[model samples]
Target: MDLEVGDKVSLIIGTETHLGFTVLIDESFEGLLYRNEIFEELKENQRIAGYVKNIREDGKIDVSLQPQGFRNAIELDTEKVIEAIYDHDGFLALTDKSDPEDIKKELRMSKKAFKRAIGSLYKQKQIVIGEEGLTLVKE
Candidate 1:
C-alpha cells in the first residue's frame, strides 16, 4: 500500500517491540512509531491521531502522533504554564535554555507558548530576560 506524507490518520497502538512499536494504520500495513516520535506517555491499545511521517528503506513506515494541528495533553494542565512562567522567576533567560525545553516537555507546551508566557511577564515587569536565567524581579 502507498502512504503519502501529511496524510491525517488515526491509529491504534499495537505491539511494542525492541526496535520500535507498531501502529495499526489499517488492516494491511502496521506502521512503526519509533521511540523518538513517541515522546509523551503512550500506552498499549491507545488510539492516536497521526500523520504519515515517512517510509524507511527497511520497509518500516513511521507515523507521528505529534503531527501539526494536533492538540497536546498540555491543555489538561493549563495552570502549569502559569507556574513555569512564574516559578522560573518570570524570565526564561539564556541560562535557562535547557529548563525551558524541559519545562515545555513536562508541561506539554510548545517553546512558542513558553516564550509568549515570558513575554507577558516581561511586559508586566514581573521579570526580565537578561544575561542570566530568569530573575525574580518581583522580590
Candidate 2:
C-alpha cells in the first residue's frame, strides 16, 4: 500500500457499524474511522480529509480526521478554543470542572483537549479562568 501512517488522504464517509464508521480512503482503500475519534457530524457519502492512523497486519487501515501527534493536537485544539472564545464575545461558560459532554457540545472537542488548550492559554495569559467560566484577557 502506498499509504503510510500520518499520510494525509481523502475520505468518503460510509456506513456506521458497531465499531465505527467505515470509510473509503483516497477512493481506493477501505478504512475505519472510530466513533470516539470523531468530533464533528458526518454523513454517508460525505467527503472529508483524513490522516492514516495505522495499517493492521490483516490489511485493514485506521483513519483519523485530525492529524496525530501531541503538538498537532494541541495546536489545533488551542486555535479552535481561541476562535470559539472570540466568537462568544470573549467569554466561554467552560472550565476545567465543566462536564465532558458539555465541553464537547460547545466546542466539538474532547474535554482533555479543551483542558490542554485552556491551560496553555492561561499560561500565555491570553485568558483567565474564573469561578463561572473562562474569559479572554483583554489587552
Candidate 3:
C-alpha cells in the first residue's frame, strides 16, 4: 500500500456500520472512519479529506477526518472554538463545568479539547471565562 500512517488522502464515504463509516480511500483502498472520531455528519458518496490513522496487521485501514498529533488537533480545535464564539455573538455558553455532552453537541469536539482551547484563549486574553461561560474579550 502506498499510504502510510498520517498520510493525507481523499475519502469517499461508503456505508454506515455499527462501528463507524466505511470509506474508499483515494478510490483504491478501503478504510474505516470510527464513529467516536467523527465530529460531523457524513453522507454516502460524499468526498472529504482524511488522514491515515492506522493500518491493521490484517490490512484494514483506519482513517480520520482530522489530522493526527496534538499540535495539529489543538490548533484546529482552538480555531473552531474561537469561530463558534464569534458566531454566537462573542459569548459561548460553555464553561469548564459544562456537561461533556452539551459541549460536544455545541462544539462537535471533546470537552478536553474545548478546555484546552479556552485555556489558550484565556492566556492570550482573547476570551474571558466567567459564571456565564466564555465571553470574547473585546480588544
Candidate 4:
C-alpha cells in the first residue's frame, strides 16, 4: 500500500458491521472506519475524503472521516462549534455537560472534540459557558 498514517485518500462507504463501516480506499484498498469515530450520517457507496489512521501489521487499515492529529481535527471541530453558535443566534444549547449524542447531533462531532473546542474558545474569550449553554462573546 502506498498510504501512510495521516495520508488523505478517497473513500467509498461500504458495508456496516458491528465495529464500523468498511470503506474502499483510493478505489483500491479496503479499510475500516470505526463507528465510534463517525459523527455524521453515511450511506452505502457514498464517496468521501478520509485520512489514514493506522495500518496494522496484519495488513488491516484504519481510517477516519476527519483529518488525523489533534491540531487538524480540533481546528475543524472548533469551527463547527463556532458556526453552530452563530446559527443558533449566538447561543448554543450545548455545554461540556451535554450528552454525547446531543453534541453529535448538533455539531456532528464527538463530545471530546466539543469540549476541547469549547475550552479553547473559553481560553480565547470567544465564548461564555453558562448553565443554559454556550453564549458567543461579542467583540
Question: TM-score for each prediction?
Answer: 0.53, 0.95, 0.91, 0.96
TM-score, candidate 2, is 0.95
Q: Where in model 2 is the C-alpha error above 4 Å?
A: none
Across residues 19-95, which tens digit of lDDT does each residue of candidate 4 receive?
99999999999999999889899999999999999999999999999999999988898899899999999999999
Best candidate according to TM-score: 4
Q: lDDT per residue, candidate 1, 96-124, as tens digits?
A: 36465575565555555556555665676
Number of backbone collisions per candidate, in order? Answer: 0, 0, 0, 0
What count of clashes does model 2 give? 0
lDDT head-to-head 1 vs 3, winner: 3
Which of candidates 2 and 4 reaches a greater TM-score? 4
Instruction: Report RMSD (Å) for each prediction in the order shown.
Output: 6.7, 1.0, 1.4, 0.9
Candidate 2 structure quality by residue, lDDT tens digits, 40-138: 899999999999999999999999998888888889999998999899999988999999999989898999999999999899999999988889999
RMSD of 4: 0.9
